[model samples]
Target: MRGTIQNRDEFLSKVAGQLGQRSFTEGVERPKWKYQPQHAVLKDAGSDELLEILKMQCTKIHTDFFVSGKSGLMETLKTVVSNYGGGPILTWKDSRFDTIGLTPLFKQIWPEENVEINEWESSRGEENIELAEKANVGITISDITLAESGTAVLFSSKDRGRTVSFLPAKSVILIPKSTIVPRMTQATKIMREKVKNGEHVASCINFITGPSNSADIESRLVVGVHGPTKATYIVIEDL
Candidate 1:
């Protein structure tokens, strides 16, 4: 491993020298364009307007959208889960589930004793992927949600693996309305701010819009080809 790293560093240093620099320490500055349209879209949008934008975008992306308060969040989630077809359910081992008062459905309220209620165990490794693949519905909360693209940005970690959202037959996104941004530009800015503030930025981030769609066979579009067959986004207003 040490030798491999040394060889990789040498290769990078040689490439840097060819790029008119002694090393990568002399990095190029980010370009600042005058006609910047990225930051312009929905720049003045309020929370309500953002929600409307997200709702409209979801229509085009083929995703179900719902609005609820913290009190109704559990009922809303259960409804979507049932609508998507009940468990075996898969969810992240996030404390936020308890913080927002939705943990009971997983730990106690869910009535189907035969169905497996699995919390992601990082130690389980490949077992996590196997269970996720078998889940009827997967539930996750958005770290950041883009209104323009109807995208839920989830920062991957050991406990909240990407498979929880990727491998399931159906998926549900629970987003706090406060996290909604205008578009990808704002999402990028948020991450840049985290780095600027010396925070530990996530190495893997998944920007899921809806169920995976593809038109690979005979020009006919098919959903769930690469991911979940159905997706629902529930926005908790009071959260």
Candidate 2:
């Protein structure tokens, strides 16, 4: 284990050397752009005003509603798709759950179209690319993302894949209001503390503000270019 750590450190140092000087040091000049969450207007907002602020800023609302981490997010997703009329594509962390649990949801949501409920254990190479192109919207239950920035952090693990957040026409997130924080720097501090205590850092860390958008085409705004055009966050309060 010690030798492995040494090798990893050496590899990082070599890569840093090749990359040249790093600019992120104390008391440095500011960069050209900063990521700010589109100002939102969360309904019934309180101490954390981010949700409300985001709601005000965005043009559309898309999200997975859940009461808790164990909430039936997939079922609620079915409800949205069924009522709204979007094609249903179900992906789960558990192969068995996909086999047993998803059938009823699909039957209820997509009674007309031939539903495609696919199971994937690993998201690598071609599979990742395919999932990105095929899925119009992706749903996820997250630990905590900064409400201020309108970002959702998914612990890249076996069950919750990173691509689920990126590479979709829309990305809808489910997060309890209690987990919402005021700023990204605070969240970073918390993550660093967790890492010091041996918490598993997922392969990717994402800070999403709005839909995948670009305005370069004749200065005309367009969404869903590199990623989903819209991101909706659902906040469930304790009732």
Runs with alpha carbons beyond 4 Å of true place in candidate 2: 1-50, 57-76, 90-114, 123-125, 217-219
lDDT of 2 at 158: 60
Say which candidate scores most in lDDT: 1
Q: What's model 1's lDDT at 47? A: 96
> TM-score for each prediction?
0.90, 0.61
What's the lDDT for residue 39 in model 2? 27
lDDT of 1 by residue, 1-239 (tens): 12334577688889988898776544769888989988888899999999999999999999999999999998888888877768889999999999889877788888444556899999999999999989998999999999999999999888998989989999998999999999999999999999999998777899999988988668788998989999999999986
User: What is the per-residue lDDT of model 2 for residues 1-239, given as tens digits with 9 covering 90 to 100?
Assistant: 22334576567667777899443325756475565433233323564466554444343323333332324545665555544346435343643334334445544545555655443347454675476568766656556756545666666666656777777666666566666765566577679888989987766766666667677859877767787766666555541
Candidate 1 residue pairs in clash (backbone atoms < 3 Å): none
lDDT of 1: 0.90
